[model samples]
Target: MSAPLGVIVAVRGEAEAAVVAEVDAHPRLTVVRRCADLAEAVAVARAGLGAVVVLSAQPHLDADAVAAIRAAGAGIVGVGGGPGSRLEALGIAVARSALAEAVLAAVSGPAPEFVAPPERGTAAMVAVWGSGGAPGRTTVAVNLAAEAALAGHRTILVDLDTYGASVATALGLADEAPGIAAAARAAARGEDAGALLDRHALEVAPRLRVLTGLTRAARWPEVTAPGLERLWPALRAAADVVVLDLAAPADAGASPQGPGPRRDGATLAGLAEADVVIAVGGAEPHQLVRLVHVLLDHDGPTPVVAVNRIRAAVAGPRPEDAIAAALGRHAGVTEVWPLPWDLRACDAAARDGRTLAEAAPRSPLRRAIASMAEVVVAAARAARDAPATVTD
Candidate 1:
């Protein structure tokens, strides 16, 4: 005969004894341990003493803890919490009544899966990141998104630069309305993130929307990885192409507040979830060095290098060729998109709160950005249409 499935009950209050009693009555299940708290339950799970942990809803229980417990080879069955509750949000909840029957159903099959609704359309996420030397990441992102929108792709320009968020300012929109942060907060509350995004995203042009970033740098903590984790899928469902203008840091390590939100959470999350990553860098010698470091340090998706402001004065004769050669030699980057110096066009666009195409259609920079956008959109479409792979 098959052995009874080992179950660990970690719930508190009266629910604990009730759950234990319910499990004991089951012939195919047995209560192996009654953990005092989440930590003890986690330890027991890590040691493989239980196949499933019956946990109670607690404020301290979060995605990280749930992930650790699950990674330790134990499935979770949350015993409490109603709609929109943390437990429900974790995708492991079983109703308080008929607990044993629910547990049996959950254990008999696979763990409850949280599959986001099929997106309205496949949207490719393009993340524009830099190595902190101000390689005009935002400028590149804004123009590319504009070009994509002009090309008939519904595009969203998300300013996730927590340090100095200027997408709203550059687009001449009022910063009073909370954009990405508000959507994130809604996602964290287990609300409709796509609906919130639709309400918060400002339509700058016909097909182009902008999700502004933090108004104050100190508000970085409000945009956590967990919140963005929920927001990303909603973003993809809302648009055809999502362009993320990330902050300079790729990996800022742990938060100074310890175990809490890190300032670079947005950037890291964007990079991790991106379908295409554009590493922007200036054409200057020093900027080239920093760009190489940025490219080398990046371990996520393969990035396309964009050398901005390729001027002969800054990068020597045939600046594009020179920059490409240097990046290839140093960073082993073969494919490089060179954007020329168009200070007049860039300044005009900034002053008018418009894109280069709108401000100066004839600008060399705009033309180059148009070409790059074509490539980006094609890549995004290809990625979206590609078949998903599964591994054991």
Candidate 2:
């Protein structure tokens, strides 16, 4: 007779032995190995030693690890409940007697199909990120969203600066208290994020909506993946363009445990889902130096660079040329958008709680920002027209 299907069990304590016994009892399914831990199981699976693996719902078996294990060519099924969707098909109260059937089903059953509707609109995300030292990221984000709206595209601007959010203050919406933190909290509680999202996002200008940031920095923990993940997609569905003002710590890959959430987790999460990333930095020597590093560190799609607040006083007569040369040499940047030093106009808009489109339409700074917004809108539209390359 043919040998039974190979199964590796990675469950904890007595449950591990019980699973092995349960699987071995079946004539079609057999235990090939019983791993001491998740690491051993992953290593073994990576080596092509087994056909199926029953994993623990412990902290070690995360989403990335599961993807890695699957890449190694082993079929993975969850043995218990976990934080992520590692083994979503299996039930929490899965019977030991049914373990063999579940394994067989995972190996032989029809793969779960994920299909997108033909009518779903493609909403593009333009993420505005700047390294440490305020480099007008909020200004760029707000204007870009506003300008896109002026260009007749539905746009949503979000403040994701966990360190300190300036979008609300700059737009004089601090009194309204509309922001993502409360929406995130509501989303985490399993409420309809779409409804909460619309409620939190206020229309600062026609065709332009703004989702303010946290009132207090300490409340950032509420911005969990469950909520932001839901809210962002919903915003995209409602608007043609979504602009996010990101902070310096956009790549805090550190996986923190328990109560103290990673302060910049929301930024990282948002970037992961963004279609375009606009790395903004000042033209000053210090800001440029950090900007080069930040640009090089980004690992997503080719990013657009904006040398914000470029002026002769700080960066010499050819500030734009100098910034471009430095970025090209160090960070291999070929193109850059120069935002002229028009502090007075920007300050006026902030003071008036209005966007440049409304406050200073004739300003050179506004013109440059409008140009950048045009580029963003065109790119986002092009991306939308192209075949959807993303896989869930």
On lDDT, the candidate that comes out on top is: 1
lDDT of 1 by residue, 1-392 (tens): 89998898889788788889988898988999998898888888888998888998764565556656777777788776776666776667666687767766666667654434456457998999886778799899999999999999889999999889989988889987799888876666556677888899999998999999898988887787877887888888989899999998644454354434578878889898888888999988899999998888888767988989899998887888889999999999989999999999999999999989899999999999999989987897787788989999
Error of 2 at 160 (Å): 1.3
Model number with the top TM-score: 1
For model 1, what is the alpha-carbon lDDT of residue 378?
88
**lDDT of all predictions, in order shown?**
0.83, 0.76
How do the residues 1-392 of candidate 2 rate in per-residue lDDT, one tens digit apiece? 98888888889866777778888999998888888888888778877788888776664443334544665766766665543333431222233347787788767754332111223357888889867789889999988998899989888888888878889888888645857887776654435557776788888888988889988877776775545655665777778898899888544455544322467778888788777888899999999998988987877877889999899998888888888988999999999999999978988898898888788899999999999889877886777667867988
- After the best TM-score superposition of candidate 2, give how far the Cα of residue 363 lies from its true spot, in angstroms: 0.8
* Candidate 1 Cα deviation (angstroms), residue 383: 2.0
Look at candidate 2 and tell me the lDDT of residue 253. Answer: 55
